[model samples]
Target: MEQPAATYPVHGPSLRKRRMALGLTVQEAADKAGISRSYLQRLETGIRERMGPKRYTRLRTALNATNDQISPPPEIPTEER
Candidate 1:
């Protein structure tokens, strides 16, 4: 049997950069964002499973991230038979 390839969420780098630019620590940002420190850490490390639109919006707003600072994942083309 062959194993499946691994996939990682894309928000980690954006989150880390925004937090750093704001001169905020992980705990501070997490607290301001109403999420747990460990949860934020995991998200920042790409260890979290996935991200939804709502969560992305919230994180973006909470971090005061600009549009250029955050980008949605590229769309996967659909297959047609």
Candidate 2:
């Protein structure tokens, strides 16, 4: 039997950058955005890829970030199995 390929979510560096730029701690940002600190951390670290529109909007508003900063990075193409 063949094994399935693994996939990773797009990395989001802008999230971390914006948060730091605003001088907000992970917990503070998460609280302001009504999300968990781990969730915020995963988003920043690319562990979690996609954020729903509501969550994205909340994070954007909390970070005072522009669309560019809140948006996910361009996905890299992966080779077919």
Please give the lDDT score at residue 28 for candidate 1. Answer: 91
Best by TM-score: 2
- Tens-digit lDDT track of model 1 for 10-79: 4677778889999999999887877789988988887874556556556667889865565545689999
Candidate number of the best lDDT: 2
**Which regions of candidate 2 fall more than 4 Å away from where they truly are?**
1-11, 73-81
Taking all chains together, the TM-score of candidate 2 against the true structure is: 0.73
lDDT (0-100) at residue 44 of candidate 1? Answer: 83
Global Cα lDDT for candidate 2: 0.80
What's model 1's overall lDDT?
0.73
